[model samples]
Target: MATIALPRPVPRYRSSSPIPTLTHSINLDGINTSAACPIPIPNKHLPVCPPGPAPSDKPDTPPASPPTKHLKLQPQSLLYPPTNYKKVTHNSSAVYLIDAAGVAAAVNHISQQPLPEAGQVFPWLHGLHPANHVQQAFFVARRKALRKTPECYRGVTIVKADGNLSCSRLKSAVTTDEFMQTAMAEFKDIDPREGFSVRNFQIQSAKTAMLSDIIVYGEDADEVLRVGSDIAKAQRSRRQGLKALGHEVPVYHTFVCTSHFEEFEEHHPEIVVLDTRGELTGNVLDFFHQERVEMATMTKASEIARNVWLGPTDDLSMSGPSPDDEPFDLFIECSDLGRANVPALKNIVRELDSGAETSQYVEFPSSGSIMPPSWPLTEADDIVESCKWIYNLANGIRPSEDEGEITDIEGDSPMSSPIETRTSRPRKILIYCTDGYTESSMLALAYYMYAHGVTVSEAWLQMHIDKRRNFFAYPSDVALLNSIAPSILSNSPALAHTAPQDVTQRIHDEPAWLALMDGSLPSRILDYMYLGNLGHANNPDLLRAMGIGQLLSVGETAAWTAADIAAWGDENVCVVQGVQDNGVDPLTNEFDRCLAFISMSPYPPSTPSTKLTPPPFRPRPPQWHINPSPLPRRRLAQRHNLHRRSNARAVPLLPTRILLRARAPPQRHHPAASALQLRAAEVGGDDAGEARGAGEEGVGMGRDCERDCGDE
Candidate 1:
């Protein structure tokens, strides 16, 4: 892909320059007008330029008047419509005295009335004419009086059902620290005559002052501690207040609800007051005295004091002590208070007196769960670290700094280069067994090889005799051999089995084994084993004809040695014991031996000689006969003598003593033959005669020989 880059054009701005002025006008009369003329011209037809310099530098300067001409000016109608204006009315009261107008002296009259007192009302009369100004004044005064009335408030608890402190109260309470302090002072005031007095109450005074129970609750109970965190800051001032008064008071803050209170009261009723309201109403002084009461109980403090402390506050002094100080026994959080409360909580702890110990309570609103709501709403990765920190803290475990790094199974860097690359060759193993080989043993052997990364390719069970001529007869022997053989053969290499009738019998007796031996194992089983049975052969009669010794010899010579084949069913059990110790598959080994025998057999070389020989010719026997006529004894004797003579002639002559003396055989035993004969003889005699005859013909025999050989 080709990328095109274009540069953005820069913006240009026009230079600030004054425009040239032009003279313009409209002709109103049939007269030539010059630029200097004082006569007014119509704007539309005014000339823009005269192609010469102006008479005056200023364009607005008036020129001399033109000469008068004897012409009468015609009157023209106004160019625009005239607007009519309406007069506004300003009414004033009129006074009248009827004297002169009635032929008696008549006079207009006016009267003045004295101003009324601040709280007084006007009378009906004291005047000659009624005055509008006094009446208007009275109306204004009445409206002002109404405006001065004070507003009245309807009393109702400002707390919301959802546990949200009224916003109005929160604003007021949070802003007015002086007002709250004054309220607290008033709470502390002891008026004997008014039946209000201070009473000291100790909580678990007999026991060491450790936290017994902490309960927190409120509308914004969760936020209570958070916003009130400043209260911890106020701790030092509070302690100062106590010290100034020569008194010691412990204060614990928490945000717990009724359920938590009940639970705490049940567990530590001695310290946690069950009926908070009862305690509050019974003794106001005692209530304030035990400032360190569990937060749940303290929530029921007198309205004045509760409002002062729990309400919103803007005072910097209210901030809490530092975080390094002991954590509060009970930390109360106001549920309604969001992130803003965190600072408050921190401030409260920071403000605590240097050595003062207190319980902390985190209060959530009635709807809020005790758990911190998931926070830092942003991308998942942004808050992941925070979540991890929170998880560690919640689980009471300290997370290590290196926790985020990735590691391998051995806890080492996985990126390091491997020491060596493994070879791709498949692992192979061969198993040998006999009738004595059990299914369990094969399975075990398979498992062992598999664990070592060696896949067993071939398994063989042999029923052939050992040197002792024992036979394998076990039924399971065939079953086990058949079961594992196919898989081993397919995955690794070829598996072979050799046995005479007994082994064959064991196989034939079991359908599965028979199927395997016949190479007819089902496709489903083949798929399961992941091997196909390619071929099979059996010769029962051959086995019967051949003795066990001869078969063993054949098997051994053919590569199926005793050590390789497993044997069973022997009374002495020598072969079986040997197989057990050696863990060899005798059957497969024997088959391998048979395969080797077939592979390495001398048959091809000996085949033509054995098969092509002609059968021996047999002579017909002479037929016997009897003479029918008895006459002529002398003629019969002569016929007999002729027969005897013919028989003698028929007999062949035999050679007498033959002379036999010979030197070494001639180098050219056949001088008539040529180089071709020598070459033909070297190869074999089958072609020597034809080659010699071709050479004798004297035509190029080489080409003929080559052609003949090619044809052959």
Candidate 2:
């Protein structure tokens, strides 16, 4: 009933010549430029200069020396100011929170300057004039003054997505392991490792979002313009939307820099400038140790500072006539502002600063912790002194036996005239930086810890998740925060009378498992189990710090020496030798051993289903056995048909006969054609048989048909 046609021969080229010749070749080296352009244009003749009066009639004069260019420093008053200020937070308090842009805007508005279009001289915000070198220098210097490092990482960086596995490996792991499904669901919301949480934990809010009393901020320097543009666009869209709804945009009073503290106080006495400037002046000339004369002559930023505050030229000096006396009103009340006490945080910054020249590890006996070299480390006493000063300012505490008055050599109030002088804490305060995050972040973190009774971890999460501010911190900064956290908590008036709670005791009593959640150890696989590379396994101290009791090495063993083992006393270490990370190696045989080692750990898995318990022994299933002798070819089809009839799902036993027929060229009368018909009938029953019968009647079958089947 069926026919098979022979396949056509594949075409092969035969050489007409004895030897093969190259085809489609071009002579690249023999390009004829002259032929392409037959005639080149002739060069134009040079005109001779007209004869001038004889040299003897004119007097020879030496060329006048070029006049030297003198740098003209732009006055602070002349610098471009913003027309309107954007409030960073929606806290309807006395103090207004604004960024550098808002500050410049406020200063311009308070000074009663008209908008640039209305005849104002400068059309740009201070330190934002792209064409002005002086403003740029001052802008760069002011931002740099507050930071120990040049760049920082912030906002949804390096976060893990999906379940706790790489996207590529997740498919297979989930497919093979039933326990993984349960584990994945359990730890979905929970952060497996700490430092930063999952991207879901990052908060996104409107421009008017409440950013508490403090905020940590940092980002790569290169991203400043892009990020600023994005923020501006978002704000503009929001403003437009609000206006369409006929709602009025709120405006708050703001001060430009600490330099105008007196004028600012006069207009808004309730707001305070929590100065967090670092030790560096951020002056470009300072790096080369330029003298005062050179700076005064060549540096526009320095000249601007001198113009604003006549008394001082140095930016780092704490002993100024007033806070505003320093260049650009830059002052360092605290050297390292906004440091935290989290180890995971410290580890992150330290790694980031690995190649930095200034970063160095320093141990502080006061905090009983080592400050990572990623940031500059300051003495504990200096931090304490700064804290005390802030405490006095906030609480309206005057000069007492313990603290000195903030005075100048003249014994007069430098902040204001004696008649206008008053002693009370500012009701509102703003902590900000030129760039979005870095300069202001640390100071804000410090303020939060000192004012609130929370530890570094709590403050970090609170600001990021609750307040909705993204910030970055260096390890040294965190270490300093750790050192000073105790004093801050104890000195905090809010917590003085309150009973000890979880927050107050968290610094000392945090659980060991917290390391995994916070990113102190390597990657966390489960609550009890962790995953790490060979490098991490070699560090016994790191494991001990995280309270990791056992080490299970796969693929590669740790490079641990005798001392490493001693340090990790009673080490429960196991290695799966000869297993390489290359995809070829099968981990099937090592599964039981690995599971046994993991289960033997003192720490139990978080869920019962993921416990990796051995299954109860049972006898082999009878269906697994195979028949030794095959049935004769003649009986095969009958047996297969009977089997299929008995159970419609049963497999047809025509594979061997089909393979033999496949090796031979197909013919119209081949007996193997019946085997295919039988297979089709088994699969689809009478309908398939009818279809096959129609196919046999309609088409010819041959080697070409077999080739098409093979291709499919």
Candidate 3:
């Protein structure tokens, strides 16, 4: 592993661009009411109460009412009602903060055509905000629709949803390095420097998704009302023509809340209501019932709200709890719940048991044998417990006496005798969250580990590379998963017959260094060995901690004095200096010496040392043994690159540019665990970065760094 030393208190990487400013004002009918009725930001003592627009001048329009009370609004809810036509337009998919009147204006403008009998209309509230009861209740009555088709070319789908491109931490742009420093600082018990590079690299390497917003109404006043009217006119003509021929038309889904149920009932008297008020359990059932819901993709929406209301700071540290603190877990059947409204989901298992004829419907069961209703999977303990629970449930273990089989029902039907005639259905577990990206990934990885009986690194590669789903898993989360993976995989049903002592002893005997790495590897690649550059060969303390009694260096010599060599033993340490790695150095000639040196024991000559010889490198499945190939330099480089690619394919997030043959493992005493176990030693230097290897395909005698700077 190559090591680069970095100076303490890392250099500042914040951008120097001018900060964007947001202004709030009040508009009363046609009059400017900013001075008289200024909006106040939410405080710790008071709920967010954005001022309503001034009473409309029109005779048919009712006067404005006082803002709602008992609302738990975000600090960013200093919004004012949109006064003009431009305020209530929907041009983009980006979520905007709007009041009930604004929503009505947009929907009314879009609904130029009369509705067909089969046409469905629903409003989807996008972002988190305070539940203004009056506004949410109004969407229940609207029967408007707009149809805008997205254009696709090549493989890219160009969404027409309105809003400017934005960042999650956009209020003040913070570099990935600064963010990692702050994030790593929180786990003070662990060495912040450890895995800092990998975590930084992970975030830097990921492509940030699209996040847009509608902060102010007055900013984009010149777009004229074409967004709503033109879309509405086209939809109106299409609906009329379709209705004439009794053809099926597109359904309308608008963003809305269930705030004012009475007003909704009054407006739509023909529709009967079953349940108006339900417990706010903060699950999918309460999606519309929520007074406040934030889009998981738009993290900066909340941050902007906080900056506008609470105040802004230059520090890059994350405020409050970790991202996706409120976990919403779902264990659904793929056949059932395939992207449908929660309300429409029915119990298919029960229906099948009763022999009831029904249309295709999916089921989403929770709160019993399935899993918990809510789990903030930030803590490692919580994650492990949840994973174990899922394991039991999936394996037909009723976790509690009160809980029953997931498919179990109370009564046996007369059709039960004919159940053998029905086709068997394959059951699948689908772990999902509100946004389908942020909060569910940890649980997904955990489930993968138990189901696949592989390391967390393998699970991660399969999910991101094979599944191709973008998920947000913090380094800390990955570390936690790695540390618990051995235990979790041991519980696999495949090992049910294995002796308890064998499994327990393996787990108990796992090297301390294994926890610090991101991937699982043996304690020793070969001999009392580690693969590193001169930097590592010189760090006596690091060598001692890693339990390395011998060192073999190629091309570069270690900075060891005679005294140092005497301390370590001249026989234990060997360096072939003055050999350049620029594709000309004959590494094959030195392999015998290197192998012989590696064969030497750290103990005195009296101690028994295994007779070591270079093993031929061969690619094999399940477990591939990497050894020095006796081939020439060019052929050896090609073979090593192939090996590196194969190993790197198992974990895509790892540094792929370079492949290292050997790495240092973490000690048992250190509680830190990462997805990979490699080490790069960094000496203090301003220009310190990843150590470079001068060879074709970036293969070097010294491998890439996999430092285990994990916390205790």
Using lDDT, give the best candidate's number: 3
Off by over 4 Å in 1: 1-477, 480-484, 493-712
In model 3, which range of ten residues has the least summed lDDT? 303-312
lDDT of 2 by residue, 8-37 (tens): 346887877776455444454555654342
TM-score, every prediction: 0.11, 0.22, 0.24
lDDT of 3 by residue, 1-712 (tens): 2321212345776778966555855456735654466556548866554588655674644576755432222211112122222323344322223433443334333234332111111122111112433323333233232311111100100111222212111111122232122222110112122211212223221111111112221122332132222332333444466568765533221121212334323453222122233222221233221211211111121110000100111112122433533211123222112332222211333333345433222222211112222323443344444454444422323333222223323333222222222222222223433323223445566666655444555454444333333333333445556566666767644445557677556556544433433221211211222233333344544344333455555554456566766675554455554444322233556678656554433343121111121221211123212111111122111111111111111111211111112222211100111122222121110112222121101112111211111100
So what's the TM-score on candidate 1? 0.11
Regions of candidate 3 where Cα sits further than 4 Å from its true position? 1-424, 434-438, 454-487, 509-514, 517-656, 659-712
Better of 1 and 3 by TM-score: 3
lDDT of 1 by residue, 541-574 (tens): 1111111111111111112224323231111011
**Ranking according to lDDT, highest score first:** 3, 2, 1
